[model samples]
Target: MKAISYARYGGPEVLALGEVRDPKVGPDSVLVKVRAAAVNPVDWKAREGHLDGLFESAFPVVPGWDVSGVVVQPGVAVSEFDVGDEVIGYVREDFLSRGTFAEYVAAPLRTLARKPGNLSYEEAAGLPLVGLTAYQVLSKVLQVKRGETVLVHAAAGGVGSMAVQLAAHLGARVIGTASEHNHDFVRGLGGEPVTYGEGLGERVRGLAPEGVDAVFDTVGGDTLRVSANLVAPEGRLVSIADVDVVTYGGRYYFVRPDPEDLRRLSELAEAGVLRVHVSETFPLHRAADAHRLSQEGRTRGKIVVVVDWDAGAEGGSQGV
Candidate 1:
């Protein structure tokens, strides 16, 4: 099958499209014929060798983590799904080496959930990584409560978009940071958007006189440190960006993906309480372009890569 692969880690130019052997499925695994895959900071980070400490890789590596696809084959021990079930999931989290950048990827059954019927393949592909990140930070680490005020940085980006929507759905008053152009988009998602640069503290404080109940930092650096001061007593602060150490009421967070959290996010999407925003979609051959756009950090939402083995295909890949 044709897929995106990298011979070495460097710039986006290192990524190339070519034919590769399909992966083999293990006994508790399901072999998915990937229809769409989502690009995250982690993908580019791994590609550029920025995550060498975490995802040490050899040559000829496929570099994507989130996918929406259809089950083409089910391993002997996998009773949870059949050969034609549509699913979306993170391929590997315990180790960041194996990912979902190809036409086929094998993943454990527990890591996947049924794709929402209301969403297209691109939208489903966009949800897994960022959605799980947002869900875990708000529901598990922070324990965000209704009537609380939560502050989210990079409010117009992938995780930020999901965070703002989820926080609002939970009945929490959300204060998010994005550029002036995204203020309307954030507000439409039920968040009070503020410009991140300049006096961010004063702006957020003006919105919430009492102070924010929790802080979710998707853009670290000064934003994380500054958010520490905005947190109310006993407030929780979580960062997926991993840029700086964050302390809020003596609490700090580094986000990780969990199968249970993915399941919960799937439930939320199925129930119509969560919505995914996909800003762009590219063919597998254009993986480098997708990486470049994500690296710019200016995209409004997620970027997806669609795999089209049959050039003239009329519809989305089978069940997905």
Candidate 2:
């Protein structure tokens, strides 16, 4: 099937729109005919060999994790879904290769969840990775409770935006850091906005003078370090962006797929407690453009690649 793949780890330039063999369905897998897939920073980072230490990728890797599609076939062991079921999944496998940036992906049941009936395929595609990251950070790592003040850095971003909405829905007083341009956007998501940069702590403190109950950092490095000073005495802190957060006694998380958590996100979406924003979309063949936009680090929401393959037509098999 036609897909975007990289022969070796490198930049977006290394990505090519081509055809590769369809992924084989495994026991406990569901073969999905992808309608849309979202781009995450990890996708590009993996492409650049930054994640090579973690995942020994095979060459000619299709790069993506977030997917929304219809099930074409379900493996023998799978019972949760059937053919023609609409689903969204964080399809990160133990290794790289069989990915969501194609017309088909064999998604393990562990990573799959029913897509919210209220959401469009693009919106559903955008949710799995970032939504899980935000939800897990708040509910699991931070344990943010009602009436607490939570400060999220880069809160207008993909994960951060979801964190803002989830934190607000949890009844936490949400404070989000973003550029001046995104302050209104953050406010609409129920967060009080603070511009991020030098004196970020002071700005956040200006709103909650006693320090916030928790800090969620999606932009790491200096932003993570600076926010460390703003955590209240009883506060918890977590960073999905920084490894150095450990130095500050904060937990750093790499997202793991949990079917239950994914289902909860879908529930939240269906209930209007969580919403996904797809700021832009590219056709599947234009995946490199999606990666380049994500690399810029300024997109306020998710970027999705729409796979417009026709089921009745012959799938492309041009690039071997």
Candidate 3:
């Protein structure tokens, strides 16, 4: 199978296109034929060894987690899906390697969900990770309610965009932080946009004079510190970017692969309540370019890497 991988932790330059052995399927897994994969900041971070302490690494690691594809084969113990069923997944493991940036991936049933009928493979590819993060944090962690005011940082980015829409859907008045250029984009996502930087707090205060009921911090460091001062009394704060949030009476969250949650996201998409904006896409062979774009950290939405199966035939035979 052809895939993008790196033998050692490094920069985008370390990633290369090559042929590798096919993934082995477990009894509780499904072999998905790759159609598209989404690039998240975590992909580049893992490539550079930032997550070294968290996950065990396997050499020549395939660096992707979000995937939209078709089930080619189901494991012996699986009955939830069969050949030809379209699916999407946050196909992560406790260890690195066997990822979704390949011709196929052996995804555990817990990470798989049927793809939403209304979304293209590229859009669906971008949903699992960011959508799950926003859903878990807003719906479960913050418990945002109707009439409450919620502030989301980096609102034009993947998870932030999803957070804005979801928070608004829950009836919260959402205030999102973005650059001047992205204010309209943020507003389109159902958030009142506030430009971030020096006067971020004041701007948010302008929108919610009493301070916000909840703050969703996607940008950490100084931004996280500043967010603490902008939360209303008895309000909540959560950060997915920095663990230091704990010191400020906030929770630092990590998204998990939940099948039911992914299914709900799919349902939301089908119902037109949620949508993933695909800002740009690259073919699988140019995955390194995708990483570079994501690292720039200024994209309005998801960046995707598509697998061209027909192009694969000209390069080499696929495992499936």
Q: At residue 43, give the lDDT of candidate 1.
A: 87
Error of 1 at 81 (Å): 0.6
lDDT at 194 for candidate 2?
Answer: 91
The predicted structure with the larger TM-score, 1 or 3, is: 3
Q: By lDDT, rank the candidates, best first.
A: 3, 2, 1
**Where is model 3 more than 4 Å wrong at Cα?**
313-320
Question: Best-fitting candidate, measured by TM-score?
Answer: 3
* Candidate 3: 10-residue stretch with minimal lDDT: 311-320
How would you encode candidate 3's per-residue C-alpha lDDT over 199-283 as one tens digit per residue? 8888888888898999999999999999999998999999999999999999999999999999999999899989999999988
lDDT, model 3, position 202: 84
Q: Residue 275 of model 1: what lDDT? A: 83
Higher lDDT: candidate 2 or 3? 3
Q: Is candidate 1 or candidate 3 better by lDDT?
A: 3
lDDT of 2 by residue, 196-231 (tens): 888887888899999889999888998988888988
Please list all clashing residue pairs in model 1, or write none if there are none: none
The local lDDT score (0 to 100) that residue 178 gets in candidate 2 is 91
Each prediction's Cα lDDT score?
A: 0.83, 0.90, 0.93
